[model samples]
Target chain A: MEQKKLITYTAGHASVRKQLLLFWTFFIIGSFTIGGGYAMILMMKRYLVEQYHWLKDEEFYDMLAISQVTPGPIAVNMATFVGYTQGGVLGSVLATLGVSIPAVAVIIVIAVFFPGFKDNVWIQRFFAGVIVGVVAQIATIVLDMGKRQKWTTISVIVCAGSLGVLFFVQQVSPIWLILGGGLVGLAVEALKPKSAGGASS
Target chain B: MSFLALFGVFFKIGIFTFGGGQAMIPLLQKDLVVNLAWVSMKEFLDFVAISEITPGPVAINMATFVGYKLRGLTGALVTSLGVILPSFIIILIVATVAHTFRTNLWVSAFLDGLQPVVLALLTYAVYSIAMGGIPAWWGYVAALGILLLILKYGKRLNLFLVLLAAGGLGLLMFR
Candidate 1:
C-alpha cells in the first residue's frame, strides 16, 4: 500500500514537472518574437532584427504587414505566429506569456496605484513624451511595411487615392476603403496581368 | 454577470476573433453593446478610442476598459484574461499540429501569396487611420513629416507625450 501511494505521488510530480518544462522552453522562445504595434517591439528592435537575426529584414517587414492587416493587434498575432512556427503549441503559450508578462505587470502596478500619478506634472510630462515615441514607433512600422511590401504602381495609386478619400471624406468608413482597395486590387491584377503576375486569377 | 461570466465573454472574444482584435469589433459591438447592453455605444466608442491610443494590445485595452466599466477592477481582470484565453488555447493546439505541415510547399506558396494581400490590407489600414485626426494642411504635413522621421530614425519619440499634447491642443482649440 505504501509503495503504491509513493508511486502515484511520484508520477504526479513527474507529469507536473514535464508540463512546466514545456511551458518554460516555449517562454524562452517567445521572448524572441518582435510583436507588431507593441512598445516592446521598439525596445527589442535592435536585439531582434539587428543582433539576434531571428527574423530577416524582409521577413520582418512581411511579418509586420501580415500582423497589421489581420484584425488583431499586430504584435500579439506576430508573436503567436512566430511562437507557433518555432515551437508549436508550447512555443506559442510561452511567447504569449513572455510578451504579455511585461504589460500585465505594468498594468497591475498602475492599477494598484490607481490614479497614482494623475496629478503629478512630471509624470504627465514623461508620459506625454512617451506618446511622441509611440507615434514615431507607429510611423516606423508603417513605413517598414510599405518598403518591405514593395508596392506596385497600382498599389501606389490606390494608396494615394485612398489617402485623399479618407482625409477629405471623414464620413466614409475605413472598412469601405479596405474592401474597395481589395476589389480594385483584383481589378488591377486582372487588367495588368503582365505587370503584377496576376495572382488573383 | 459575475467576474467569471465576464471572463467567459473575453474567452469567446479570444477564440473567434479570427483575424485579430479589429475582427472582434463587430462581435463586441453585437454581444457586449447590443445583446448584453453592458454599456452604451458612446461608451463603447470611447473604449475603441482608448484602445487605439494605448500602448499595449488594443483588444487587451478594450477588454480591460470594458471590464472595468461593467464590474470594476475585478471585472477588468477577468475580461482581459478572458479575451486572450482563446488565442492561447487555439495557438497551442495549432502549434502542436503545425510541426507536421510546416515544411509543405503548397502551404508555403499559399502563405507567400497571402503576403501581398496582407500588405495591401495594411496600406489601406494606415491610410484610414492617419487621415482622420488632422484637418489642416499643416496637420497633414506633421503627419507626413512624422512618417518620414520614423523611416529615417526610429521610434525614439515618446508616445504618451504626443497624445496628451494632441488632446490638450484639441481641447484648447476645438473645444
Candidate 2:
C-alpha cells in the first residue's frame, strides 16, 4: 500500500520525504532571510533550481511572475505556489507553516524580551551592511534571469519601457505594466500566422 | 483588542496588500496607526524600523510585531495567520487553476508575455536597491565582489555567511 501510494503521488512529484524537505527548506529560508520578499527570490532560486533541481528555470520564473501579481508577501505566495506544485494542498500548508514560523517566533521573542533592541546602533549598522549584501545578491539574480529570456524586439521594448516607468515614475502601479505585458503577448499571438512564420522578430 | 478583531484586521490587511513588504507599510500605518489607533505613531515607526532590520518578510514581521504589542503571543499567532491566510487561499486557487490549464495555448502565451515584464521588474528592484542602499564607492565594490563570488562558487557558497561577512565589513568601515 505504501509503495502504491508513493507511485500515485509521484505523478505529481510529491513524496513524504520530499514534502518534509520542502518544509525544512522553507523553514531555513524563513529563518535567515532579511531585507524583504525580493531577497527571498534569490534564496528560492538557489534552493529550488540550483541545489535541489526541483524546478526548471522557466517554471521558476513563471512562479516568480505569478507571485508578484498575487496579493500578499511575495515570499509567502511563492512558498505556497512552489509547495502546491510539489505536494498539492498538504505541501502548501507545510511550506507556508515552515516559512511563517520563524517570523512569528522571532518577533514574539523581540516583542516580549527586547523591544528596545531596534535602538541598538550596532545592530543597525549590521543590518545596514546586510542590506548591501542583499542588494548585490538580487542584482546577480536579475542579471541571470535577464540572460535566460529569449529577447526579441517587442520583448526588449516592453521590458525596458516598463523598467523605465517603474524606476522613474514611482507612481505607476506594477499591475498596469503586468496587464499591459499580457495584452502585448496576446496581440502578438493573434497576429502570428498559423504557419511556420512564428519566428517574427 | 479582541483576538478575533486582531485576526480580522490583519486578514483585511493581507487581502489588500499587493507587491510585498515595503508596499504593506503605508497600508499598515494607515490602518493601524491612523484609522484604528491601535498603536501610537511613534510605536508604529518603531515597528517599521524593527521589521526592516529583522529577518523574514516585512509583512510577517510587521503583523507579528503589531499583534504581539496588542495582545501578546496569541495575538501574534492570530495576526500572522490572518495576514498569511489570504495569500495562501489565493495562491492555492491560482496555482490549481494554472496547473490544470498549463497546457492550454492562451495561458502559455500570457505567461510568455509576463516573463519579460517580470524580468524587467526584477531588474528594477536591483536598480532601486542600488540607488537607495548603496551609498559609497566601496558599497559598489562589495556588491560586485559578491556577484563574482556567487558566480564562481555557485551553490557551494553559503549566502548567510556572505551576509555576515558584509555586516562585519559594514562595521569595520562605517563605524
Highest DockQ: give the candidate number.
2
Q: Give each candidate's fraction of reference contacts reproduced.
A: 0.12, 0.70
Q: Which residues of candidate 2, in runs, are more than 4 Å off?
A: A1-13, A196-201, B100-102
Error of 2 at A11 (Å): 8.6
The stretch of ten residues in a row with the least summed lDDT in candidate 2 chain B is B99-108
Tell how far residue B15 is off in model 2, in angstroms.
1.5
Off-target runs (Cα >4 Å) in candidate 1 are A1-47, A58-72, A83-91, A101-139, A150-201, B100-102, B154-175
Give the per-residue lDDT digits (tens) of candidate 2, residues A79-136: 9988887888999999999998998888888988996899887887787788789988
lDDT of each: 0.52, 0.82
- TM-score to native of every candidate shown: 0.62, 0.92
Put down candidate 1 lDDT per residue, A35-66, tens digits, no spaces.
22444444334444665454466555444434
Error of 1 at B57 (Å): 1.0
**What value does the lDDT take at residue A29 in candidate 2?**
94
